[model samples]
Every structure is written in structure tokens, then in C-alpha cells.
Target: MPAFVLLIAALALAFLLSRLLRLLAQFRRIQRIPVSTVALLPGSGQAAVTGNASGAQLSSPFAAIPCVFWSIEVQEYRSNGRSGSWRTVLARTSDAPLVLDDGTGRVQIEPAGAALFLQDRFAAQQGMFGGLNQSTLDALERLGVRTRTWLSTSRRLRIRERQIRHGERVFALGEIARAGAQAALASTPDAPLLLSNRDAPALARDLTMRMLGLLALPLLLLLAALLIGVFG
Candidate 1:
């Protein structure tokens, strides 16, 4: 019975440790972003449609919007003698069809999606899990949220760039075009990217929290085992 208890405790400890590590990582990631920005991303379809309605309608008639789609693009720079070519990253279903420039024969990506994709692509490419310890990996596995792949693929573009103007801050068209090519790919279906203009930080935070929960499994089990020991 004591041996059995130890086995149970070990399993529990493994689970909890995994959860805690995942949450901590997520928290640290979220803390890096500005909260105000996440607020600006579009909400649920119903909320988006009714945002301009009467004040009474705006109170609490609808469910909160959950993240649906989020993507990032990145550019890679390589040298081919004196000339260079730019490739689009983060292709999605929603993005405009790519067209070859007649004069330059270069591929062009819509600016907005391109920028967002690049930020995420760069982040992923840099290896977010480079220094993660074994405990963290165990936690991620427990949560079933491991990074499967992050490569570029030839697919329809899903994110389109939209220009936003705010006073003197002018994002030039050519400026955004500099980010090389989008190469980082994401996991699908079970791990669909959560999209929200302002919620990246929140999403990162939630991921961290969820990881922590997984890590705590061991502690919870240990408590249960202690109780069983006293009772048995």
C-alpha cells in the first residue's frame, strides 16, 4: 500500500510540475506585451455587429468573444550577389491573392498581415523554448500543447494588412515590405492560433497559467495520497 501510494504521488508530482512550468512561461510571455493593444482587436461577431447599437443593447446581452484566429509572418534575408528577393510569410485564407509585380517580378504581400506575421515569425524562429528545462517540457506535454512545427509553407494567405492612421505616426508601405519572407508555420486544428489584436499578451498569459495548472497536478495528487495514508 505504501509503494502504491508512492507511485501515485510520483505521477501526481510529474503532472503538477508540468502544469506549473507551462503557466509560468505563459505568464512571462504575456507580461512582455502592452495590455492596451489587446483591447483594440475585434471581438465576437455579434459584438462587432452590435457595438454601435443602443446603450441598453450594449450592457451584457452577448457572450464574451473568444480568440478565433491569430497568425504571424517573418522575412528571411539571403544574399544572391547584389540583388535580393522578398518572399511573403504567414499566408492565410483571408489574405489577398499574391500578384507578381510586372516591373520587378517580385512577390508582394499585403502590409498589415505581413507585419503581424513577421513579429510572430521572428519570435518563433528565435526558439521560444530554447532554454526551457525538462520540467517545462513535461508540463507542456501534460497540457498537450507542445510546439509541433514552425516552418513556412506555400499556402493561401490568411492575414491581410490593413493600414491604421494615428496622427503623425505614419507606417509607410515600403517600410513594412522590408521584413524578407514569412517562414514560421503553426500547428493546426487542436492548436489553432488565437487571434485578437490586443490579446496576444493575454493569450500568452493564459497559456502560462494553463501550464501552471498542469504542473500543479503532482501537488494535488500528493495531498490526496497523504489523506489516503491517514484514512487507510
Candidate 2:
């Protein structure tokens, strides 16, 4: 049993390493991307831009707050009726196109599968068996909650959502192109697009911190293995 546990632990550690390496690769690409104004990017190839996010300012279907892009998670505090854990009731993201304007020009962004880093625009936790808000109700309708209507009063619902608010400064690194009169940002197979709310320096700082952790991870894992072997 101990050996099995050790093997499982080793596999888990390897999975973590794999994920960290992938993130490191992504952040490396982010660091290499040179930030430019929306006007300076070319019609093709790798391009990066910094600008204010704007578009059809629609309310986030889940959060009901206005923004360019949004992601949301609805969870319920579920338990054995005593002690409990949060269970994800549903999760969704907005696919609406966003525009990035940097004084000189505007570029439309297609956000699917792109690395997006934005701040939370709305978060709330109602008390035990609290009332569901309008946002939650709308989300339920959109998610087809007919069979799950019990969700309304059965659990302690909590909502968490993030969005790139209207006029919020953002960074974009992606494939730039001209679609007729409009410029656009998209991800090519070779170069993935990255969208972030932070400026270049702030993003670089975040990358540096994550890279440091990734760099030290292997050594830490090795040390942990050795310690376990000795103490087991």
C-alpha cells in the first residue's frame, strides 16, 4: 500500500511538472512579444498591441455586469448536511467579440482558446440557504435548469465572475489581420493569442514569479522524494 501511495504521489508530481512546463512555455512566448500600438501592427504574422477594451457593451449573462469579455462560475456549498465542500453547479464564458483601441486604431479580438488574464468584476456569497439573485436566475434559465430547479433553494449558491470591463486597458499578443475595413486579433496554429489586463511590465513581473516557481519545482520534488524514501 505504501509503495502504491508513493507511485501515485510520483505520478501526481509529474503531472504538476508537466503543467508547469507548459505554462512556462506560454509565458516565454508572452515575454518575447513586443508591445505595440494598434496602429503599428501589420496585416499578418506575430503582432502585439496595448489598448483600451471596448465593444458592444453587453451585460455578462452570468454576472449581469457590463464588460468586453467575461467568464463565470456558479457553485453551491454542498455537504453531507453537516460539513461540506463547494460543488460547481455550472460554468460558462462569453464569446462576444471585443475591440481594442489604442488612440490610433481599433482591432477586434477573437478570444476563444486564447490565454486571457482579467480581474474579477463580481463575486458574492449568500448566507446558508440564501436567496438567488437575478444573475443566478438568468444563468439557470440559459443553462436549461428545468430538471434542476431544486438548485434554487437546496444549496448555498455562490457566484464568481471576471470580466475585462469597458475601457479597461489591456494587452494583446496574437495574429493581426485586416478583415476588410476592420483589423482583427486571432490565434494561429503556430502562435497562440494572449490577452491580459495588465501592462507589459506588470505581466513580465508575473511571468518572472511563475518562472521562478517552475524552475525550483524539480529540485523541490527531488528533495521531497529523497525525504520520503529516508523517512518512510
Candidate 3:
């Protein structure tokens, strides 16, 4: 029942509560704004749109798979004698401009700083005896990442690639603006664009689950502190 322990737990709880409140507000705001079609998009203001993305095909960094949008995350496992943990070595995302077609009309999307919620398209792990494919090796080389130490076999590593296939259905949230004669989605400093394969309802459900999971630890800590403070 140390006062410092109680104080630390209380602070952690307060910080997490603030984050939860912010996320809740965001969820409410998104819920209030109805999803719009490209043809019906407002001349100016925030809007959510769903469409099939069209763009020049690009090769994924790790898998070399064709996609319109791609991201790769590379992590290496390190052992601390008795325990092991994975540390990220490289991460990259594509910043390409694409068009979203909803059958009614098309809108341009610049995805540089957008938040992406994409599912993994390719995943692989390599251990001491395992070897990475030539394409992946070439990709790692291009990124200037060496898998092995100076003299030893490559360290245990995992690589995951996420992508949006050309013409894939997508969900987008951002400000709607006119790009010359065409309508487009643009991100502002206050509201960065959000892109996802999942629809709004699905994204909200995922966010709720995340908030619930985040709630558990802080709540448990606060409860423990309270009980200890009362009975210790």
C-alpha cells in the first residue's frame, strides 16, 4: 500500500481514460457524418466515401506482388539469454495517388499521410536454417537491410506485407475538395485522411474492441490500488 504505487497507478488510469474519451468522441463524429458517393460529394467539407480504387500497379517491397497500395514491416528476433523479443528493423508504406470509383463518379486520393487499415497479404519467417526467397532478398538488399551478422547466419526474422489490390474496394474518410474539374479527397492538418479495406461499421467495431482491451489493464491497476489502499 505504498502511496507512490497508488499514485503511479492513478496517473496511468487518468491518461488511459483521456485517450478513451478522445477515441469515443472521434467515433461519435464519424458516426454522425453519413457516407457519400463520389458523385454526391460536397464541394467542400468532410465526407466518407466507399469505392473501388484504381491506380498504376506497384510491386510490394517484400513480396513483389502487384498492388496499388503496399506496406512492409520487417522485424528481427533477439534473445536476452532466457527470453526473446522481436524488434522492428524496417517499415515502409507507399505514398501513391489513386482514384476511387464508386460507379457514379471518381475522386482522386493522395494517400501520403493517410491512416491505413489493411490486412496482411503476405507473411513469412526465416530462422537460422531457413532462407528467404530471391525476390525478398533483392528487396532487403535494395532497402540496405542485412539479415545476417558479419559472420553468422541471418538472424531470426519475420516479414509481413500488406496491400490493396488494383481495383479493390476501399473505404475513405477525409475532406472533399475540387481538384480542378475533378472531385478529390484531401487531408488537412486537423483531420488526416483515413483509408481502410474495412467499412465504417467494421472499423468502429474494431475500435470498440481496442478501447475495451485498453480499458482492462488500467481498470485492473486502479482496482488493485484501491483494494490495497483500503486493506493493506
Candidate 4:
């Protein structure tokens, strides 16, 4: 309502706009690359490969489920009565090469530094009323992360796990790297790899929806600013 409030809002919107524009640019770049199978992959260039994930699986730390890739995050809710926020206590990810088979061929791809888009396999919260299962609690304790504390009433623990399971369809985008007789899809400085469980079309749709949502907020803010300037 005040001039200072408007100024702060304007600055915030500008910052958000910069981030959104960068994401939009990345979305365009990904959309332009055509999806290719492992067999039809070219000798050299950027590539988008679709195939089924296969290989030795990692045991998820929190859930202990078998997966080609797994990521677990634990956050603790901290509050000062007036405000509250979730603070990450621990985060872990499995970094292993997995085999991708597109029926025509198979390629080994590394998972490090790749942007993963997979559905969460498990998500739950732990509080005074309820807590994570005993096995999970034991695992966390082994990791030296104490889920229970003297101030448990004022704090809550939350955990979530995401995984890429074996035999699941996966989409990978990056440049091709050759090692002797084998070729692998990998990330470059300019073109980082992206791995997702969704197909190309579905992934594109999701990106489009996110971009639209980002654009909508800025437009609404601009319109509101205009109305305030005219009638204030």
C-alpha cells in the first residue's frame, strides 16, 4: 500500500523475472532438441535419448528400496513463534552409472549433476503425534542425525525420497561421449544433462505449464501496479 512497499515489490518482481527468463531460455533449448534412441545416436552432437533403465540398483538410505537412483532429504521445521521455516538437516544422492536400453541398443550414463524429474516414492512427516517408522528411525540414527530432541514439541522432522527404479522408462538429454568401444550420454559445461522419468512430450508440457505459471504472476503484479498508480 505504501510507496516503499511498491518499490520493494518492484525489485522482487525484477529478480523473479530474471530467474524466470533464464528458465524459459533453458526450456526452449531442451524443446528444440529432438529425442533419439540409443541405436540411432549420431557420432557427435547434443542428444536426447529415451530408454528403459537397467543395472545394479542402489538401496535408498531412508526407504531402503531398490532403485537405479535415489535421493533423500531431511528437513527440520524451526519456528520462533512468529515465523517458521523448514531447514534441511541432511541431503544425499546416489551417483552411479546406469544402463539405458532402447531395444535397439544400450548405453551407460552417469547420473551426477543431472537434473532429475522423477515422482517421489515416499514422503512423510514426523512430529510429537506421529513419527517415521522404526526402521527408518534406526537408519537416521545410524547416520548420526537425531530425529528426536528435547524440544521435539516445538520442532518437527520431515523426510522425502525420490527414486528412479529399474525397468522404468527414462528420458535423457545431453552430449555423447565416447569411451573406447562404448558411447555414453553426458553433460557439458554449456549443455547439462537432464534425466526424467517422463517422456519428451510430457516433460515439455510440464515445462510449458511451469513457464506459464511464472509469466502469470508477473503479469498480475504489473496489472495491479498499474491500477494502484492510476487510482491511489
User: Please, what is the TM-score per model?
Assistant: 0.29, 0.76, 0.80, 0.83
Model 4 stretches astray by more than 4 angstroms: 1-11, 128-130, 150-154, 219-232
User: What TM-score, to 2 decimals, does candidate 2 have?
Assistant: 0.76
Candidate with the greatest TM-score versus the true structure: 4
lDDT of 2 by residue, 72-148 (tens): 77777667866888888776777878898999988998887677666677776656545667667666667754313
**RMSD from true fold, candidate 3:** 3.7
lDDT of model 2 at position 88? 85
**What Cα-based lDDT does every candidate model obtain?**
0.32, 0.76, 0.83, 0.82
For each of the candidates, give the backbone clash count.
40, 0, 0, 0
**Residue-level error in angstroms, candidate 3, position 20:** 4.2
Worst 10 residues of 1 by lDDT: 46-55
Q: Model 1, residue 41: what's the lDDT?
A: 22
Largest lDDT belongs to which candidate? 3
- Candidate 2's C-alpha runs over 4 A off are 1-3, 75-89, 126-138, 144-153, 156-158, 211-232
Model 3: lowest-lDDT 10 consecutive positions: 21-30
Model 2: lDDT to the true structure: 0.76
lDDT of 1 by residue, 113-133 (tens): 332311221122223223334
Q: lDDT score, residue 152, model 3?
A: 72
Clashing pairs in 3: none
